[model samples]
Target: MSHDLFLAAKAAMKNAHAPYSKFPVGAAIRTTDGRIFSGCNVEIASYPEGWCAETTALGHYVTGGGGEIAEIAVIAERMAKVTPCGGCRQRLAEFAPAEAKVYLCDDAGVVGTVTMGELLPYGFKGGILKK
Candidate 1:
């Protein structure tokens, strides 16, 4: 099942439009109910205006009707281990629980898996917004 998520990410990487950076990235997330959402990095000339793969996938998750994320998979071309950036880590926390499994893929299958809590141990979340 985890490998299925990685395959989805790898397939999404083919759609990345990163001309300037040439560093295409793909991400896939499994919703709590078993649906898989995938996205690839979309780059723009402005650099900062581009969106990461995870955010793209998360956008789909939101528009497709929000739900908890059960697992996440990420893949890059050359990186041996491609983990989500700080922004993605926090974004994932919005849907995934602290113990949600994350898969970082390389060329083979799932290279490693870590919990969301391990990814962002001290993250500041909207829990603070209640006040």
Candidate 2:
């Protein structure tokens, strides 16, 4: 089932709109309810206005009424491994637990799997700010 998520991410990468960077990325997230959401990076002409694939997938999951991501997969080309960026890591933390599995993949397949906490230790939690 995890491998299936990676495959879905790879499929999504085909539709990435990265004309400028030429570095396409795809992301897939599996909710605790067993539903999977996939997304591709969409780059814009304006700088710093682009969205990461992980953010896109999270949006789809939230829009679909999903809660608590169990696992996530990120795939990209020409890299040893692909992981979510810092901003995306925080975005993912909003809907995923610290122990959620994060799969890093390349064109071949999954290269590694790390927990969300490993990706972003001491991540900013909304409750912390509320105090």
Candidate 3:
């Protein structure tokens, strides 16, 4: 909430590959160590083959040697207070704690905020996958 994730997400949104849907979105995730990873939506020719911005950011976060996620920020070119999709919510919940802040931003700045748990109250528990 106090970091530059809004700016980071806005910058990433400019690089989105969204020719098909023309809906460019961006996401930025912050690790507890203050590292920020940002990503943009990438759409392909196939309708459902494309991934969301949060997915790309998660990829970066994972490959960057993952840690506890502190917060997340998301923005869209045409929409304000844009939140992550369902799949992304689950993916984020895997790394981010229930208390982690999720910022919904517009072009200007963060307009709203929600915790990971609040956003996905009925989310599938990750512990079930542990063996």
Candidate 4:
């Protein structure tokens, strides 16, 4: 599963539309039922509308059909952990459980892994939306 996710993320990174930051990123998430969704960073002239790779992947997952994300993989060029950004973290919390595994990778492959809870300890769940 890790290998498959890594490949998915790597494939997505090849198409990153990062004209501004040049910091291309890719993300892939696997649903509990064994479906994989992947996306690459897409940047727009207006930074506010640009979506992170994680958010884009999550969107794909939801749009296809609602599912619980069991695992996430992120790939970037750098050696550092390529975890999701703050906004992406919040987006992930909505579909992934607190213990969901998140894999961080570079061109060479996975560099590390962490749980969703660890990445966003105090994240805002969808409780407000439920109300």
RMSD of each: 1.0, 1.1, 1.1, 1.4
lDDT of 2 by residue, 1-131 (tens): 78999999999988999898988899999988889999999999994689999988988998999887899999986565888999999999988999999999978888899999999998899887785
Better of 2 and 3 by TM-score: 3
Provide the overall lDDT of each model, using Cα atoms, as 2-decimal numbers. 0.90, 0.90, 0.93, 0.88
lDDT: worst 10-residue window of model 1:
76-85
Per-residue alpha-carbon lDDT of candidate 3 for residues 1-131, written as tens digits (9 for 90 to 100): 54489999999999999998899999999999999999999999987689999999999999999999999999999999888999999999989999999999988999999999999998988689899
lDDT computed for candidate 3: 0.93
**What lDDT does candidate 4 reach at residue 93?**
91
RMSD of 1: 1.0
Q: After superposition, how far is residue 111 of candidate 3 from its true place, in Å?
A: 0.5
lDDT of 4 at 111: 79
Best-fitting candidate, scored by lDDT = 3
Model 1 regions more than 4 Å off: none
Ranking by TM-score: 3, 1, 2, 4
In model 4, which runs have C-alpha deviations exceeding 4 angstroms? none
* Candidate 3 positional error at 72, Å: 0.1
**Candidate 1 lDDT by residue in tens digits, 13-69:** 889999988889999999889999999999999986799999999998888887878
TM-score (all chains, Cα) for each model: 0.96, 0.95, 0.96, 0.93
